[model samples]
Target chain A: MLPNRSRTSVLVFLLPPLLLYCAAVLFPILQSLFLSFFSWNGISDMEFVGLDNYVRMLTADDIFWRSFFNALLYLAICLVLQLGGALVVASLLTSLRRGRELIKTLYLLPAVISTVAIAFLFVRIYSIDPVGLLNQLLHWIGLGTFERAWLSDVNTVLAAVSAPEAGGSPGCTCSSSTPR
Target chain B: MKKLFRAAAVAAAAALALSACGGVGAASDPANVSPTGEIKPREISWLLSRPADGAVINIMKKLADDYAKDHPGFALNLITTPDRPSYIQKLETLAAANKLPELFDTDATPFAQQLAKQGKMVDAEKLLKSLDVYDDYRPGALDYQRFDDGSLYMIPFQFELEFIWYNKALLEKAGVTVPKSLDDLPAMCTALRSAGITPIAIDGQDQWPLERYVAYQPFRAAGPEFVQKLKKGEATFTDPAGQKTVKWMAELGKAKCFQDGFSAQGYSDAQNQFTSGQAAMYNIGTWELPSLATDKLNSEVRDDIDFFTLPTTDGSVTSANEFVSPSGIGMAVNSKTYDPLVSDFLKFALAKYPAEYAATGALSPTTTVQTTVPANATPLYKKALETADTLGAKQAMPWDTQLDPTTNGRLQQELVLLVQGNITPEQFTSTMDNTIKQNAPKFFK
Candidate 1:
């Protein structure tokens, strides 16, 4: 769309950044792909064992399948709850004119908190001995018998760890779907 | 339009400059000093990976202050990443970028061995020999940090072992004696529960403690050599010894020996429960010695805390004398950053570490450093040292450390399943054997 001289100028300007990006990100990703074929402990000699890592991961590794299925379950929950809940909240916000900013800020708090901080906060909230906030709430509600180690129980652990992650970016999702 | 172009050009130039300064070739210029030995201040960065409560950082800060008083040319800049997994990630990232600090604390991971192979880490053994402190280390302290080929890469900070701390008063109240063998544990737990006390407090959420429990019965049944054989695929986890070990562990779980909701319990949670006298026993490493010595614990039980090793199983080849003694985190120096001043600082730090450690009722890996037990030292600390003396070189390597990383992860997960009674001992061992077999070729020849 530009004149020949302008196009040349634009290309010159873009070349430096393009080369820099390739050096920083793309090259390392490509290198990792190459390294994946070899059996290397980083300290020892790299032995070429083409496709063995993949073969093992796909076949004999039961944990890999467990983790894969676990991840899919998390994704499904996030899609249904996080994105869907954000849409509902965004609709409610759009109907409100008064205290809009305050409610929005409160809704966005979890989304804005650092991942490390959220992890630590959730860890404390799930602690069993001192009784975490969740367990304490259950006790207050006269449902104390239902309170068990949320993070440790095989039935609850996957859901416990996933809950925070699902709640983390709700505000971002809400804003993205909000009508201008 | 012209102003926008100028700003863009400036931004690109700045980015390029930053990138240039980041690579391996860009070592910061050394500070110049005057003839009168008036030195320009230069900060030697140290990346520490340790728990803040361990008082290691406090002691290091004190040492740095003392060093500064003399040199007046140096300042120490410490950056701590306290969590182990994140700390290892940061170290690996820095090493990959060739931007490691002048000094850094690290575990004896495969990455550290790789760094040694690449000649990027200082030869700690050679440095110790030069300082005439080569003979100072306790027997076998340095051996644990060596690579498969016997090359030393890390300087051991503290010698550690896993042990059980029991409340003597609680045991007495329950009319249960200290358990001398694995068989005695179930009865002890039942007696404690009958006396209205929680039995064993374990950190099941972290899962490593559970893994240790699984490893112990096997360690007793088959001896330490079995682990090496298992790693090589020569021996399977489904071997009778290993299966029996898993079955016993599952039985303990079914018996409710551990505290209620233990599967969700954390290390600190378990510790607090035991120290507060809510539980009869706590299992932890020697690193927790300082915490045990602290007055923060329940006064009623603090004075009554004592420890004992897990007793051997029936038909066990190894005795209770053999224990899980792994080397704690070690400090490594950047080979590229080595200078006379750095070497002097290290010599001073290593010399003072043992003495400072003793004040907190903890012992450094060095045997040569003389210490008078501090007035505030707990009796449990004395018991820890006595236990350490009996361990010697026959230390059981942790399953996580000995097995390949991928296999180790699955092993921990399966261990949790076993403890949860979600999987049979046979199922757990079969899964472990399959995973170990697949990865053994990578780790073993």
Candidate 2:
């Protein structure tokens, strides 16, 4: 073991990091926990509801559960599209060494693009009109019969947005009415 | 010598931090109140959500600039965000950080009501009265701002209404007559589809349009009980009108009158479909007119575009068909702000809002001057206006207006399930009922 001087110095060196952790992460989380007790709107004095908000969220708020489960579903989809694809890609790149730099740049291109642009592009592609690129691709691939509104139809919205076929980020947000 | 230099450096750093905070505190200090109760040269901020070319923002800027030039004692600094989706999040962030601007845009969404209940917004009735031109505003526009006890909360902006827009050229070519009642919709939709044209291109991708069916249509078709019941808690959303609305929604989905992937298309996408001449009729609000009127739109499509008042159920009591909301977005002053000059700016803004709105190609909630009625405006806008007198006279809580965030979220998802054909209207209503049961018991009582 080091002398007592070494132990004291180590403790002193760790102090700043510990304080930063408590101030940033720990405090906010704890504050949220306490705030959840109240029925108060964010402004006025918070009234203590004693776990009522939690109870209501689970038992009565179907929207809350829908949002919750939908998020989980999305998370699962993301894992498959992102993690699974990345692994396959990394392995392929490792095994096939030629032209790897060009391929890597192409693959990463979409991930670097702005989200709003991606959303706008996909919107055009998924439009029901036959002129949409996705419909054109469907026609070219002999899947024209399956060409339908990729975004607007409630039936295909979730899965249509799943892979997005672009990059790691998925496009399956709640329908526009749900609000950001 | 090195240790002494290090100690001196640490002391200087500590002192600099203190001075920086002290400087900010001093700068933030309120200017002395003027003897005449006028504002003492100070910057008051207004946060709003309006797109870059939006007519309302242009009017607001002009009025603010004009006021600043004349008043000299006050300056109104306006901050705006382009989209509504991010408006609330940004506002909440500002509020939490104590960076709340003096005047900010707000809406009648339950979230806005939450902010008003928290006392963040100024009493708008009081503000209007202070201007001495309160009577100049079209009556009934302020109804949405009122709380459960009838205290006003938000001041509405768009003060707009929704209606149906059809392509006259397409209708004339197809030989399908304009539908005058809800019953006529079936034949209209069926005939249009049979002729190889999509009937009504709805933006079901966004759930708000679904409100056109669930909340607005029932009242339009059957009567106003749809809104009254929700307001009084005497009627549950599970009623026949509500169910009828949902059934119609499902039937429309099954009929394939909407585009193939409608659930994904947003407002703009649906608009584009009609504008491109790919669709027969588009369902939207008055706010869409500015974009629709642009020269970039398909010439044939633009000329053929015409509006129609929402038709009633042909013979139902209270089937009067204008759907108006004072709950969209409006500029709200912070309660903490107090200045006579700020009042002067507001006076100028409200007084010119009607005229400025017309200049910007916007319709106003205030009836007299809000609209000169676009010379080319479809007859529907004026027809819809004849029914505007009934606004706020008898109503119920709009679908998402009264619910807490959690419940509203459930409707957003489950409502999509209904549209997808995975669920029924009954299921959707039950899910919503369950949401209220689980979340808002007090309101139910």
Candidate 3:
């Protein structure tokens, strides 16, 4: 509903940022897509292979497929633990009458922590040789039989790694979802 | 509106033009040797993977400082990244951009061979020959840095021998004798486990330590040639040598040789386990001698520590003396950055390096130098140094360095699963053979 002159001024003001977005974001995506047609070892000359790279990745490479499935699994777990857990916590926080700020701060603590520190912390917790916290707790409860190396066991390793990713950011989501 | 559309199009075109210019700017000339250039006394950078406080870095820093005293404008810039995986990623990225510093550390892996082929790395053998210090290097140390074609492009700086360090008291308590052969290891593990002792402490978190275990059986069965051929796809994991190795690893797993959850353990954790007498054996290198063979070790386990050489196997092609003795990761000079000053500084540094490094109770790569064992060092330290002199010609080339990166990664993962009993030896062999067959040609050729 702006007048013609004002509308032109607004468009002029937005032009620089729009151009930057195209250059920074769109260009890299387009370049990567273009590079997908070639096989180059960064230093070597790029050789155009048409669709050979895509075909091999989809059909021949077992590791690629395995990693693809792992990514999907990670996404599913992250959705459940991050969004679902955040919703639950948000609902509980909205109901609380007092100490809600304190509880929220506690929940948000991990979100503020660096991922590397969190990863190291979890590694220690999952460790078995030095009797980590999880194992020690299990032993205290006489559930030592259930205690195993969470990070190393092939069965648990995927879920073990996923858990830290899921747990680290749930508080941010919770804070967003909570009623103001 | 029409004028606005035209203006937007012009802006977009200008942005594209700028991006193209940026791309052109990124395309650098290929690294080349400038043999006739004058010596420039400026700062030179060395990107290293060793610990900042490690003996190698400490000695190098001293040498650099001393060299700086003579050359007024010279400064040695040390960029250290202690973590291996991250360092490799950074190194490879810098290499791709043709921005590798004046000096950098690298193992003699296939990737390094590619760099050498590209003429990015200086020929270390030729450099040493020109410097008149070629013969001073230990043969084993020099051999470790040579490519399959016997081309040397990396300089060795440190020598280390991997050993099975054990607690004598724990072995006595378990009533297990020191293993004399590779096959005897499992039985020894069983005896130790039967006495409620953890048999071995391994830093499986790093994955390379477990990969080292994979190399031992093959080296004993077929000597170093098996891996050499296997890496090039001329041999395979299903071959007799590879089969023996896989089976032995599985047997070690069955015997509960390593501590429970060993793969989850870090280097320090594994070291602590052995030093605190919680584990009976630790397979580590001589780099650990400062702590393991010195009074710096825990007092309770200090007197009980001893090490044995990698044991031989039945029908072993390799001798007892031939094992995993590596001259650490080698340092490569950037051919693009090489000049007379760099060469002069190297000559000065290399001359002083061996004696200084040896004086710190660490093994230098030079044969002319001997490690001055600390006063607090145990007899075991002296014994290990003597054994280094009698080492055989053949060395157990680490598989992690020999195999292509992709196959090497897969092997490391599969090795963990194999030792964890998640995969059978047959499955491991088949998968690895198929992996090698697929990837070797791309890397080797």
- By DockQ, the best candidate is 3
DockQ of candidate 1 (2 decimals): 0.25
* lDDT (Cα, tens digit) per residue for candidate 3, span A1-180: 566658769778887897788779876666677668877655555668999999999999988999999999999999999999999999999999999899999999989999999999999998887778998999999999979999888888899999999998899999999877
Clashing pairs in 1: none
iRMSD (Å), candidate 1: 5.7
Model 3, B11-100: lDDT tens per residue? Answer: 666655553333111322223322556667899999999988998898888889998888889999999999988998899878876788
How is the predicted docking of candidate 3 categorized under the CAPRI scheme? acceptable
- Model 1 over residues B59-162: C-alpha lDDT tens digits? 88899999898888688888888876678778877875678888998655555665765677777778777667778887667866765566666777777778
What is the C-alpha local distance difference test score of each model? 0.75, 0.63, 0.88
Q: TM-score for model 1? A: 0.80
Candidate 1 runs further than 4 Å off = A1-25, A92-105, A124-146, A175-180, B1-47, B52-55, B58-79, B93-130, B146-152, B172-175, B190-196, B260-264, B315-321, B332-349, B386-393
Question: Per-residue lDDT of B54-106 in model 2, one digit per residue for the tens?
Answer: 77777777777787686675566778886655776798667654467778876
Q: Against the hidden reference, what TM-scores do the models get? A: 0.80, 0.79, 0.93
lDDT of 2 by residue, A71-100 (tens): 787777768876666666666666655776
Collision pairs in model 3: none
TM-score for candidate 1 (chain B):
0.82
TM-score of chain B of each: 0.82, 0.79, 0.93
Indicate the docking level reached by candidate 2: acceptable
